[model samples]
Target: MLHIWGRISSINVKKVVWTAQELGLNFQRTDAGGLFGIVKTPEYVRLNPNSTVPVIEDDDFVLWESNVIVRYLCAKHSAGQMYPTDLRARFDAERWMDWQQTTLNPASRPGFWQLIRTPAEQRNAAVIAESNAAVESLMATLDRHLAQRTYMAGEHFSMADIPLACEVHRWFGLPQPRQSRPNLERWYAGIRARQASKGVLDLALS
Candidate 1:
């Protein structure tokens, strides 16, 4: 059986869990980060030197980095479909995945940390405001990009949707106010409706 290490509350872990469920793989996940605290152990460090919450071990293969795991799983099990076989299409998926990690996630994380993880008295209002503002701008970009397509990579639901959708789930879960971007909301609603997202998206942020 494939083995995964990460607590469900971690967004990165949720991406892997959802991807695994979408692929219909038989797997086991252990709570290993946040309050769970197994990530620093030497055993886990040997699996992911970065000490990240989400790591996967499958039949002697060890992988870390949440987005990469999503790509690897889809490429392995659902090639030419979830993974995208065309050169342009595959890289288009890659581009958005990179943007989610490099741009959107970073912008929204401060809001999530301040609003969800930190106690109200300790939270920084400025940080939350800046984070929300950045996300709103980025979301407008996404909303425009998604206006013509049903999914990130095109009409089909591909691995590209997984991490980005996870990102939207996190951003939207924040208690901060946001104006509805119809296209963005539509895209997120579609992914949330997936059976693969049942436990993942429904989870509350910590």
Candidate 2:
């Protein structure tokens, strides 16, 4: 049996969880990272030196990094669908995954930390405001892309949707409604309708 270590609320963990559901792969998940505090243990560190929340052990194979997990799942299970058979199509999926890691994360983390993670009195108003503004602008780009297609890569929903979908959920769950990006809302609503989406990405904020 495959074993996974991560806290559900962590977006990276949610990516792997959602992928597993999409693949219909059965696995056991253990609570680690965040309040669970297992990542620092020598045992957990042996699997993932970075002490990341998501570490998967399958047979003798050990894999960490959320995006890599998503890719591996798609390749192993949804070969022609999520992973894509065409080289160009696969790169398209990979590109969006990288975009989420590079662009959306940096733009959204400050606001997420201040608004959701940090205590009210300890919040940085300036940083929160700036992050909010940055996310709004970044979301517009997503909105325009989504306006053209049902999913990030194209009409077919692929692994590309997984990482970006998690970020979009965070934006939607934020205090202020991002009314400026109606297309993004429409796209997110579609993903939220999926059973796997409900299972993995719909977790309550910590």
Candidate 3:
């Protein structure tokens, strides 16, 4: 059996959980991080030095980093399906996953924290505005790319969509002025319709 350590509310944890469900892998998830506070303990630190929510123990093989875990699961289970067998196709999926972490996530974090995590009294309007603009610009890039494809990598849903979809859920759930991006909207709708996305992507934003 696969043992996963994380709190469900974590976006990163949600990525692993969704991938597990998509692959139909039986996994046992233990709550950690945030209010749980187990991540600071010695045992948890040994599992993930970053003190993050998601740490998976697949037999004796321990893995951290949510995107890597998702990729590992897909490679070990789904292969040509979620992992993508072709060289160019695999890199395409990898590229989008990297973009979510390096580009989209940083652009969206301030807005998410200001609007969703912070109290109204402490929220910074300037930060919110700036972050929103940055995020919107990044989303516009995605909108253009999605205009010709059903999923991030290509025609079929792949591991590429998981992290970005999680990021999108956070941004979209926030109370903000959003410009019309027809293609992004359509792609998100399609993701929401997946049965595998149920407990992960379909949940209320934390």
TM-score of 2: 0.97
Per-residue lDDT value at 78 in model 1: 97
Candidate 2: Cα lDDT at 194 = 91
Q: Candidate 1 — number of clashing residue pairs?
A: 0
| Steric clash pairs (candidate 1) | none
State the lDDT at 80 in candidate 1. Answer: 98
| Over 4 Å off, model 1 | none
Q: Which RMSD values do the candidates have, in order?
A: 0.7, 1.0, 0.8
lDDT string, candidate 2, 32-121, tens digits = 998999899998899999998899998899999999999998998899898999999999989999999999999999999898998899
Candidate 2 least-lDDT 10 residues: 172-181
lDDT of every predicted structure (CA atoms) = 0.92, 0.89, 0.93
1 against 2, candidate with superior lDDT: 1
Candidate 3: where is the Cα deviation over 4 Å?
Answer: none
Model 3 C-alpha lDDT per residue in residues 105-183, reported as the tens digit of each score:
9889888888889999999999999999998899999999999999999999999999999999888888877998999
lDDT of 3 at 25: 88
- For TM-score, candidate 2 versus 3, the one ahead is 3
> What total of clashing residue pairs does each candidate reach?
0, 0, 0
